[model samples]
Target: MNASVLPYREESLCFGPESRLIATLTLPGDHPDSALPAALTGSAELPPPHPHLHQASRTSAHPAAAGRAPQRRPPGLILLNAGMLPRIGPHRLNVELARTAAAQGVSAIRFDLPGLGDSGFTSSRLSHDEQTRAAIEDAMTLLSRTKHAPDRFLIAGLCSGADAGFQMARDDSRIVGLYMMEPYYFPNRFSNMFRTLRRLREYGMRRSVIRILQKSRFTRRHDPAADSAPVPQAAPEEGVRAAPTPQHFAEDLRSLLGRGVQIKLIYANTLMGHWDMRHHHRHIFSKLGHAPHFDVELVPHTDHVFTRVEARRHLIRGMAAWLRRIETQQHASAA
Candidate 1:
């Protein structure tokens, strides 16, 4: 295929302090942006953050900045590293999602924070969580400089990555969307019942059936792929918080909703481990009656790490669909 006709183009980048952080930038091709609504692809424009920075980004030396006039940042997403996993994500899930987002006319960047993947550790005094927040802000700044992309941003993360994104969203107004996969879920009165159903009936019976089949030599041995995704790393050493109190969570979430921020909680399974259950947010949103901007999803029968191909497919599709919905609404409201 010709260089210009490719569905999308990806370029490696070294940005942040001393230009040491590693990141990959993916931008949509001409045809890729055609299908997405103008809202999702960025329609209205505003002036760039800085006149000098705007001029620098328009220089032809950078592919992302090249060929576009200085304008307000377009809509984009920041794909954070899953815990300490590289920016590519487990099984390169981040790469797949970035390409998918590109196909819809949005740009995406997957970057390594200090000490993860190819990025080196920092000597800063800030704690890890604080560093993560700063790194995310730096990513947005990088986009503003490199691609003019960051007016309204989205973040996709899993586990610890999800937690960090959640904490950052509370303080960062630029963040307009968040995908928190297996984010922390505080338990409620229904927690024990859900655990019983998941453990004895859901898990125990399946194991029993498998054991019976193996004893009778009637079925092939069942083996699952190894999942190397982060396993609940220790709580944030300082600064950033892991989980907020239920009251604080409800308050903060309501505030985000008031600001039109979209939230999607993607769980690995229905009522899986960690005292969580489907419809777990009733206590939080009960008085609100109906909040159009909030929702929950469960990738049924998947493990915590989402090793299953089908699970990841479901996640990517859900993300794309949600992005379209939220962006369309945002654009309509802005109009």
Candidate 2:
């Protein structure tokens, strides 16, 4: 397929009260009509139906005879922002991913959440959770109106975007697959500290000491409770909440898995300080212990945002392969 010919449309989608999100919707082109087979030499004639056979039975055997419509494809992809990055993604990763995926026959929509990118804030105040949920619901509603009217959805995001995607999959059954890059998985303090010490040892005593001093100074400067003087705790924001504990994350993962949601978790090497390594996923979700539904990949020599050219290429390829796998699985199940 000449990908350049694929059609795409850009529009402003309204979601929450007084909020408008900028989005681009891409559609896969229809397959070229097959030339009628040159009249086959002596093609076998079809057998006549039984005298009492119902019209429905005949139609079922030959759908075209009754003008039965072709089955609709599943929902298209949804690309989200990473942290405060716009829908273009860091280094235009989201745009690249969407276009490449579209070339592969997976339609996609990349959009900005309210108050982020080009989107406007809601009329009324909404917490982070509320806003995330509402924005996704709105995106789904918009996609549902497309010609495909896709009911099942796949969501991909990086960092905080990944966090929101995970939360959405947990809450919504319609979400069938999630692509998460450097998602916010809480670290096990003891294991994390051990790994940090091991990493420091590799850096030699001199550099490690300097790093420790810098870390200590940073912690002391930021620790309001470290001072002898009594200080009042800052109040939490109206809609913002504390990060979820490992237990909460584990439970959520288990729930999504039980619901047959396919998940891909890619962690950049920079996250080793917190996530330690791929095996640490077991530490976080001991009960789920390497469930098949969860596909985890560790990107070596990469920063959280995959800023390097090689790293970006690696990310794109990895995501494309995973998306293809999910597509195959969906088709198999549907069949």
Off by over 4 Å in 2: 1-16, 29-72, 190-242, 271-275, 289-291
Clashing pairs in 1: none
What C-alpha lDDT values do all the predictions have? Answer: 0.72, 0.68
Model 1: lDDT equals 0.72
After the best TM-score superposition of candidate 2, give how far the Cα of residue 13 lies from its true spot, in angstroms. 5.6
- Expressed as tens digits, the lDDT of each residue in 221-331 for candidate 1 is 544442454456564453353677777777877888888788988887656443354345555655444678888776787877789999999888987898788767766
Q: TM-score of each candidate?
A: 0.73, 0.72
lDDT of 1 at 71: 47
Cα displacement (angstroms), candidate 1, residue 74, comes to 3.8
Off by over 4 Å in 1: 1-4, 31-73, 188-241, 270-275
Model 2 over residues 1-335: C-alpha lDDT tens digits? 33223333233343434536667665544432111111321223222222221111101221132474665466568899887889999999998787666556666788888778888776757786787787787777666655445677889999878888888888788898888888865555466677677678689889988878887856555655567777566665433434577677778878888888888888887735434664465656467766667877778877889998898898888777877787777678778
Predicted model with the maximum lDDT: 1
